[model samples]
Target: MNSRAIKILRELLASDQPITSDYLAHILDVTSRTVRDDIKALNHSLHMHGAKIKSTRGTGYELLINDDQNFRHYLNQSLNHVSQEQALLDSPDARIRYLVKRFLLAERYLKLDDLCDEMHISKSTIQSDLRSVKKMLEKHDIYLDKKPNYGLKAIGNEVKLRFAMSEYIFDRSETGSKTIWRDQLSTIADADKEQLDKVWSVIINQIKENHISLADIAINNLYIHIAIAYKRIKSGHQVSLINQEFDEITKQKEYRVAHHIVRAAEEIFMVKFPPEEIAYIAIHLLGTKMVSQTNMSEAELENIMEKQIQIMTTKILDALEAKMHLGIRHDKELLIGLGLHLKPAINRYKYGMNVRNPMLQDIKLNYPLAFEAGIIAGIVLEQEMDVSIDENEIGYIALHIGAAIERKKMQSSPMCCYIVCASGLGSAHLIKYKLKAVFGSRIEVMGTTEYYKLKQIPFDKTDFIVSSVPINEDLPVPVIDVNAILSDKDIAKIEAFVEEDIDHVFEYIQEDLLFLNKDLQTQDEVLAFLVDQISKTTKLPDDYLKRIYEREEIAPTAYGNLIAIPHPITAQTNDTFLTICTLKKPIDWADKRVQFVCLLNVEKDSKEDLQHMYEMLGKMVDNPSLIQQLVQCKNYRDFINTLLAQN
Candidate 1:
């Protein structure tokens, strides 16, 4: 099977229902016939893998698994093979990626004929590919300089070129034996690889000698910067840095390691590195890791930790408490951890260094509520210190928040679920046992009883009721319907009630709060419009717009999927409400292009478990399909219907 077949298998795995071939064709930009052929070939390969594609007459194709273990092993093998395979530049998108990589790495002009011959495409096709390549490069401040006879070359600032190369050269998602940057170096010529390895060995040795520990990705990033600096200097493109900046950078211990690393590289590669190059390497070291702070005393630690960081941490905790109402604001461990982390983080921002966060996705998925709190914390710090907090830094902050949330959970009472089963005592006991096995001590099963006895039980004693049979009675608490046999799906249904929030979402969403299909171009215009509309109904703070702008400065509320959740820095409204506005076209919201803006306002000093509502919004941020459906909504009813359907 080819890459297209792999794509077909992936799509099948992602969906639970049968997906139409036409839909797959539209996604892949191919014909329905091609999709069918690919599915056929895919089924042939899956015969031994314990999974096969089943096509319905009028519906589409679905993946039927015979053996879970076999299917998983086969899928892993296939994905690994896909990762190692050579680049397929046959399609327009693939050709554009190849063109961009080539332009980024090329030392000289690349002729149109050469590119056409390389990709086996026509001049017109190559021209179209170049346009896309230019657009992508422009994001990194790199541009294509096309000459009539000399061909096209990449022209940009040296720093921007290195940043672009770091992104394009390595496969970030590689999961094989070879390290990411080393695997990327496999594409380079043997001679260039030899030269690059010399610098890599020197950096490794010097960092080891200095007792500096760096993650694999950080090491790869630093190596790429050094490798780029080496080539540029050899080609007579020395980086220029002011004496004062160089002097200040030299004061750091990383500069000492960078100086030695460069001297060794200068002898092995026989290329002199300017002082500015050493300072550049130092910046990477400073951003990537912290020197052993364990040796410092309590007084020393306090002295080293600037007063602004303490104040910032307090502000962040206050904001988290005010908005999410997560009861982890008073966690001492969180305060110290976040405070220490921010001390170095602020330094990284000051030097304009980029740090990689490998567990960002996992943090977002597993600890979504904590991650949202981290976003709030990041905004507060950004406002206080006047620094840009990227998602990477936010991930580190989320770790502290996640830990604090865990601590808070440890302190809180377990969630109580009263069982309402129509089955006999034996069946009820079996269901109770299954629930206990799945949820452990975190969930307290408050005994099981028949539907008749359910009303006799106190409603305030339990958070929710899990039932084996449907209950027609209007209960005070939410009732979760589950199966008598207690399957995984049944357990999931019960778990949904564990973090469930009150259904105040639609209540707060009035028709007046919604602005659909508006001709808004900038973020400021959207904010002003939403704030002004809300002001007409109720009094707003005089600095409401200023507060919203401040939150944007902390980090963008645009968490991708064309959604931006902009809220005030502090709670300014007495009532909790949302003002939703959808644009006619997408506008740039920080680094993300957003069409939907959700202006959130939490009630001041209100006590409520709003985490469930935040989790629902987080799901919208993670799902593009949901965002698309919400954006298509023309009225309050349609919007509410979409939200209900998704939840």
Candidate 2:
């Protein structure tokens, strides 16, 4: 089977219901006949692996596993193989990536004609690809320096060049990833992959022996940086520090660790690192890992955190509370986490280094509210410390803020539930025990009762019903159906029920704020229209427009799938609401195109969870069908109905 078949199998595995071939074709952008053919081949392969795609007439296809163990065993090996067989230079993204690696690794200037011939593309095609390549390199302050006849060579600061190479080249070349946040690097070369693994082992041993608590990503980052340094040094290139403060870094604990690491690496690779190189590596350690012992208490860690970081963290949380009122001001975890993260972040800012966040887009898309809070935190840090914080640093801050939001959610009163099973007492009790084990104190199972006797249980006290059998009768509260013996999906459904609140999202929507399709051609025009439309009926801050623009300067609010959510850099609106504008034509955002623009305003000093509102908007971000409906809606009533239908 091809990649499309693998995609079909993946989709089937994710959904419980039978999926129509047309629906699969629509999502995969293939013909229905092609989908059928792929499904046929996919089903044939599945049968031998203890699973088969069951075709239901008039409905579509579903996956049925005959033996879970055998299927999982086969899946592990099959997916790994499929990953290795991916076409590296087939897609546009892959092509641009190939060109970048070519430029970064080139010793002499590259000839445009040679690249065109090598990639088997016309001159115009390679030139177009180079445009994107140039844009990407420009992000790291690297630009293509054109030679009269020799073609082009990438020129930038050596440190920046290494940063770009690690981010774009070595970071993604390997498929193996140990964590979900981002892929970690252990080796840069496949032929010499084993040689690099020895170095990785050596680094790990030093970290453990020193009682250092470096995250997976940090270790991986160090791996890439060290490998790049070795390569650069071997080529007679060393990072030059011009007017950088190395005296302060030398006295730091990480500097000693970096010294030990390089001393060990010298024996393994037969390469001697200069003192400046050691300082650079130490800078990385400070940025990635904060030295901590296993026996250290939270109080000890707090005491160790710099006084300046403590003040900055306090201001960050205070700003968040005053503006968004996210209800995380008192979160102790957030307090400690922010302080620890910021101390190293100060070093990164001082060094003028670009922090790479692979999860920035996902963070922006999924956690817009927290990302907004991150923007405010960055602004506060800038004001207090006089340092600029970019989107990548804001993303790391968002992770901490997002965690605080979740922790607050978990600490809230547990939702009540009554376990109802068709079988009279015994089965209900069995399910009750399971729920208790799974949820702990997060959910309070009020009581267990038969479906027929569910009325005896007080409905007023219970928030919802978790039934072993389907409940046909409508009740005052919600009903979540699960199997007598819970499966992972059943647990997920209940978790979603507890964590999400999407029903009341329209409370923030105002008919006067909704603008259907207008002739806005630019981002500025769209923002002006939304602000003007809302300002006519309501009083807004004099600098409301300025705030939104300031936020844009920090990061482009345009997330992909034809949508952009613009808001103030810091919350200043009197009430939480959304002023929306949909453009008749797409406008060019900084990085992506935008048509649907949402001006998100949060109430000042208000205590409300923006998760549900953000979740609704997040779902719409990548939904092609939903966005089309939003774009084509003609009036206020129709537009609202479309959003209502989304529920």
Candidate 3:
């Protein structure tokens, strides 16, 4: 019924054995009923496409196509038809060539034997494939080289590689088949389709007017434009291009220059331009007929466009403000685009340029929606000016913005925490720590204030009052008073009051799992690797590692085998990083000597990571021969290779 459902179905089809409905539901993150509905929907869709998706009574759905090879061939042919219709020269051979080229691009040098092994093909077949690929490269005026001793390599222009990849991956219809868009759109309800059609119409008009070539644009942007058009229509606004009459002037040099400028604009603004606007901009800057030979230098274009766009942006903003009667709000999106355009000019006129505007700082301090947003903004700004902003600086910015937003929001319907301390700052500090730990960094703690202070201090803003100290009066807000320190009884009460809230916060902030560097030697080596990875990934204080080691002293991870697994079941770690190592010599572990050791450093709530770790460990322990191979490994890379090579 949906893209996610289709993905689940595909996964089921690819699986070796039948999958249960419950398993499908869990994997899809949907209800079992929803999964059943999805199966029915999938069956209907398959039938419409002249295929069938069969489902067993107790088992899951499977594609019932008799010939896998024929299906693949048909799919490829359909893709080729779409490509030709779109004026894209894509064929089955081209698709294979592109895949090979992409694989080659990832490596500096590749051995023919290793590649043949990787592809699971014969030497002659690989040789033929390579020859075809070499010709394709040469057609683009690129060259592939092979030395007598060395391996196959692509050399020459870097632009050629980038351009080739961009065109092949982004424009090819075969590639589009791999995406969710086709499945999702096909299954849309009739009512939704009508709504979508209206949105698409506006987008089509915009594209036509702007002369935007779909060939050059990414699918992501195309999807975004359709979404924006839908939103605009829903809001009862005319979905029209801002600059509709812009003429297309596509010279190779100018077009490339313009594309770069527009790309910079999009990055700075964090917005995708309408297809038409992108096309118009490309033509205007490049020329009418963009020849491959004609290319503008980045420096020349950046210098000129910087001054021009600044004036243009100012005028555009002024016109919008005047026409809309809504005051222009200087935000990160506006400043970034403005800064991008004016960066070169600012660099040239460093001393004389007016930098007195408070807008930049104001935007930085106020507008970002997330911690990542501030980090990205700072990175973009630093890159524009050829400067560096360290992680600490970015972190500081995020904190400032976070604190400011928290403070502003707290101004209305503020949260109150009553510190229940019998005496001293130590007890108060402990209570404060526990409260913040459970609630968050944002909870306001009114420490050891008298009952009079609770009455005098704005109680209207107080959401919850927690106190361990003696209270004479009944508080206006929910009073959570405890007799002693955070005992089991006290913790139970606190948890009961805030279980839902805590769960919601944890859902948002929880990390998935951190994979190991896939490098380590012995079980001891893996233990050491885990320690190092935990330090970097978590950014925990130095003393935290010492605490963890001290805890380990009480119970060594060696569980009576040649294998050892060391871990702490606490939320102290940010993510789970597995450090697997094979000892050159078997180490005495518990009762059994172990050649392999895996150290799992997981967050307390990370059940997924723990389960995965458990499964991997179980698999390794079940096979003694695999352990022997791992022990023979000289380095971490070799050890990982040996581990993966196992059946």
For each candidate, what TM-score against the reference? 0.66, 0.71, 0.26
Off-target runs (Cα >4 Å) in candidate 1 are 1-37, 45-103, 106-156, 175-183, 186-202, 291-308, 357-372, 415-609, 619-647
Better of 2 and 3 by lDDT: 2
Which digits, one per residue and each the tens of the lDDT, describe model 2 over residues 339-455? Answer: 888877888887766677778877886777788789889999888878778898899999999999888876789889999888768778888888889888878999888877877
Q: What's model 1's TM-score?
A: 0.66
Off by over 4 Å in 2: 1-90, 171-194, 242-244, 291-302, 353-362, 385-390, 413-507, 515-564, 571-576, 581-597, 602-647
**Pairs of residues clashing in candidate 2:** none
Candidate topping lDDT:
2
Candidate 2: lDDT of 579?
85
lDDT of 3 at 520: 43
Worst-scoring 10-residue span by lDDT in model 2 = 173-182
Q: How far off is residue 266 in model 1, in Å?
A: 2.9
Against the unseen true structure, what C-alpha lDDT does each candidate score?
0.76, 0.78, 0.46
> What is candidate 2's local distance difference test score?
0.78
Clash pairs detected, candidate 1 = none
Please give the lDDT score at residue 65 for candidate 2: 99
